[model samples]
Target chain A: MDTGSSPKERVVTDQDAQNITRVEELAYELKISQVMTREIRSLTPDMNMGDVLDIFRSQRVSGAPVLVNGELAGILSIEDIIRALRAVDLASPVSKYMSSQVMTIHDYDPVIEALKVFVKSNYGRLPVVDENNKLVGIITKGDITRGLLNALQHVYHEEEVIRYRASHLFEDIISDRTSLILRYRIKHGDFTHGGNASANIKRALLRLGANPQIARRCGIAIYEAEMNLIIHTNNGGTIRVEIEPHQISLEAYDDGPGIPNIQLAMQPGYSTASEEVREKGFGAGMGLVNIKRCVDDMRLESSTISGTNLRLKIFLREKDAFADVSQQGKETKK
Target chain B: MKIVELVKLVNGTVLVQGDRQDRDIKGGFGADLMSDVLASIQPDAVLLTGLCNPQVVRTAQVADVAAIVFVRGKNPPIETIRLADQEGIPLISSPYGMFELAGRLYKAGLPSFEKSVDPDCSCE
Candidate 1:
């Protein structure tokens, strides 16, 4: 149309030129942090979970940072709140259940890096920390969306972008009868004690009459998470297991350095373990991969600044519902 | 052998209602790890373990094992026994260690047939 109607070329006015320059500046400056809204209100570790719930309702923040002696001690996320309300007795203090090791960030970290943390952790929000590890501000999933909006318009690693959402995809068989919630602190490099938390979950599921399949899925996911801590994080962290009637959800966390290249870590046979772990017949680096294969829904989120926090949700299949599915063979015996 | 027959073999004292001995038994496996047993076991089989842990009995209950015989004369924890009793799985005590007891059963035609690995087994 310009070739026919216009004599030469329409000039970009001064205002349009200014607009283009502004866009360029914003394009360069819009890291993930640009979309992040800073949230600073938090709860002390000593506060009751009830207070945390109230804060969630009153402030409308997805989660709040928990402090101890004015230092970042833990986090109370919506998932934590959901687990507590569903499983824990309301009267209990947060100290009995609050997540101690948490994912955090420095305000200066590029927004792209922060997105990596959220992607690895599956947590909508992460705490911002100062050099002294004190709570400064907070970042949320909203920040991620805004950052992506400002990113270069071209699709970068479209397939690699983690997009699976549990609630959005399939309504997991959510039955509280088999569901339970257990929170515990993990110690470092204690492989012998690694399976304890998962064992406790299996026991609870049995007591709650969880279907064998659901229970087994829960066991596998939880066991992998426990072993991840022992092998990767010399200092163990924390795990919260939620047993729904049809699904078992495990949230395993550690304050260890978050995975920088989750894409590489998720690849089969990927491992960062030392020689000692390989000798123990462990750390083939199939833990998360196996967890994914066994579970119907798998989620992971992490960042380099804070440690890794993972959430795995596995639904019960029909096979585990049967009491003894393994007894059948090519030649049946009795 | 059936649970009733296994009970006879072990010379066990039936502390709970052993009526479920009528339950079908297609095979038998002996192990201690709940996940291991749960991962490979089938229902109606006789389970032999010396773990004495509550999780052992829970595993038996979940896997639908018809009976559990504690080897090495070991006794399952009280909670485990209680759970077995509730689930109607027979619980027994054997003075023989797992290797001795399993060997005897194998020799008596209860062979240690390797279970086929489930390619999609969630409990790796």
Candidate 2:
């Protein structure tokens, strides 16, 4: 796996990162046995080189493992055949053309190990053997490429199916007014999970067929409110989002220790967060301001005894609407 | 500018290389406040912050930030790296301070992603 250069030393571009990461992961996870060709095309050591050329041409294989009584002995490649041709020894025995220093790979070893061996040894193929050293199969670079492509295609199909199902949620249901409500309970001072709810809401909106701009607006607004709950509440709070075809309503409310001055609290750079909270790069008094910027409607109600409640709404334009309102009206009439 | 080029400009080390390293950065936003980042940053912009925590990655995810650069060569915790990787947001650490990195990026033709706050808006 060590390619004489650490990851930090490599100049990784954004495109390379996305591509290499997936291929790298697949290489480490896939086993040699899983991607190896199980059928053996073995060549006996005593076979004539002329016969070997006939087998290679018919099988369309560049190489094969040389075996004696089903026991691994050596590998004969196209290069060796070329050498035999150059020497005018087509009738020579297979052992004369085969390379006895065969590099074999374990059946259970990760495909990445084979990749490393290939890079280091510049071998075109390797014989696969089980733990008992019995020849099980043969693996080529082409086999690994095909295996990775199959795995990637499988994942792509699954994700597309899920997206199709989720995007058609409103269309598949019959209701007078269809709305999906998502609720999340935020823990106070839990900085680690602060934006989790917002992330989920954004993902849900995207899955539900909302456009990227709309999902982003909702994400930013909800994120600010969620963070406020985590940073300023006595017992944390709950964030509830009711998503309709035309509008999205988001509400975050806490129990106690409410804001004393609503106007001041709404002001940018006005925060009552403790010194400790400020050290963590939050409590900058911009959460409410940011939420207001992202939402079309914003309402804040609070008291020292009753805590605070913030509600936000964004009305989707016709082009950005998640579902057809006219279709819903017809369904309601029926 | 390409993120790899930007990284080279600041002599930064990539902690988590996200899926899109070749993504062209439209602009840059330098802020430690997550809310400011959420409010001002436009999509495809690189977020440069002094804060090295998981929330920064969360904030980037919400804002659709192209990447995050930690100034002063500060490496975030493992959890932060994991979150950034999962979200497909690249994370880099620079040996320079926030001001220097911002200036260098700005000099390198990266525009600012910040939207100026409207003074008369009552939403605040």
Whose TM-score is greatest here?
2
Expressed as tens digits, the lDDT of each residue in B3-107 for candidate 1 is 666655555544444434467666678865444454456556677776665555555554556777778656544555555554456677766667766766675
Q: Could you tell me the TM-score of candidate 1? A: 0.38
TM-score per prediction, in order, is 0.38, 0.86
Tell me the interface RMSD of every candidate, in Å.
Answer: 26.7, 5.0
Report the first chain's TM-score for all candidates: 0.41, 0.84
lDDT of 1 by residue, A151-205 (tens): 5342323312322222112223322133346797877777545566776676566
Docking category of candidate 1: incorrect
lDDT of 1: 0.63
Model 1, backbone clash pairs (residues 3+ apart or across chains), number: 20
| Off by more than 4 A, model 1 | A1-212, A219-248, A256-293, A297-308, A315-334, B13-22, B32-35, B58-64, B76-89, B103-114, B118-124
Residues A1-334, candidate 2: write the lDDT tens digits.
Answer: 2112223564544423443355678899999998999998999999999999999999999999999888999999999999999999999999987999898999999999999988898799999999999999999999999988887788778878877898888778867888999999999989988899999999899888898988999998898888889888999999999999889999999997999989998888999988878877778888888888888899999999889999999998878887887777677788
